[model samples]
Target: MKSAFIILLAALPFAAAAQTTQAELLRRGELTGTRPSARSQARQTAPRPANTASDPVQQHLLQTDVNLAQASADQLPSLYERFIATTRDERRQWTYPQWDAAGQVLARLNQRYEQVRTTLPLEERLRVRSFQGEFHTLRGARQVKDKLD
Candidate 1:
């Protein structure tokens, strides 16, 4: 009876280890799997972009700027209106960071417009002023939303 009790105690650890799955052992750092391949190691070590431009809002704004730059005077109003509409729609879905990024872009765009205002035709300048006004309005709404949050 004493020998049987000693044997049971000795077998307990083996029983627990046998119940542990291979994945569980790996997760606990008690086992090692195959080494990562060269391709995987290279991917892990690769340098990332300084500005990944991962934000969709920033990407859209860049494309919008390109479109605005190429637009003719006759197309300016329609382009501006489309931009305003898209911005309004996207504003509702934006996170705080996204909204802040948009605000920065709008502010920069307004500044650029102001700097070149004298070079632009009067009609074009007026259109840019309208865009700046819309940007301010959106910014005001964002501020109010931020306060509520």
Candidate 2:
């Protein structure tokens, strides 16, 4: 039992990482929705003066920004779907309680991921993924070791 507990503690990170990746992707997708499109840019720049404040080029750029904002907003649901899929597919050697705890962690991660998604830069998101992966690996190993004993 002692060993099992230890193992679970260690594997927590892997579970979290898998979960976070899904969440991040979802967030990214949402953010991209509000961004501008390719064709719009070409039209905007074709006839505009380089320095004009109200130039078509500038307006297009602004539109692009708005598109990105819309995209970002759209990303969250996608993330949730992917996250759910990944978790569903991952192999679980965990006991019922361990699994339940893992589920709870996933829930917490989803909540936090959404919160962080609002303002997180790409680099920070990457870090979150790495850390979450490490956590899962450690927790998984601990759980296995305990079970074997």
Compared with the true structure, all predictions reach lDDT values of: 0.52, 0.43
> By how many angstroms RMSD does model 2 differ from the true structure?
16.4
The segments of candidate 1 whose C-alpha lies over 4 angstroms from its true place after superposition are: 1-56, 62-82, 145-149
> What is the TM-score of candidate 2?
0.31
TM-score of each: 0.44, 0.31
Per-residue error (Å), model 2, residue 67: 30
Local error of candidate 2 at residue 8 (angstroms): 20
Q: Which stretches of candidate 2 lie over 4 Å from their true place?
A: 1-99, 115-118
Model 1: per-residue Cα lDDT over 1-149, one tens digit each = 99999966866655454354645433332222224346535643676333333445544765443433233454444444555666777777777787567655554343234334456677776775576467556755665545545
Q: 28 in model 1: Cα distance from truth in Å? A: 51
Angstrom error of the Cα, residue 83, model 1: value is: 4.0
Q: For each predicted model, how many residue pairs clash, with residues at least 3 apart or on different chains?
A: 0, 34
lDDT of 2 by residue, 72-125 (tens): 423434443443444444434446564445444343343335444657667656
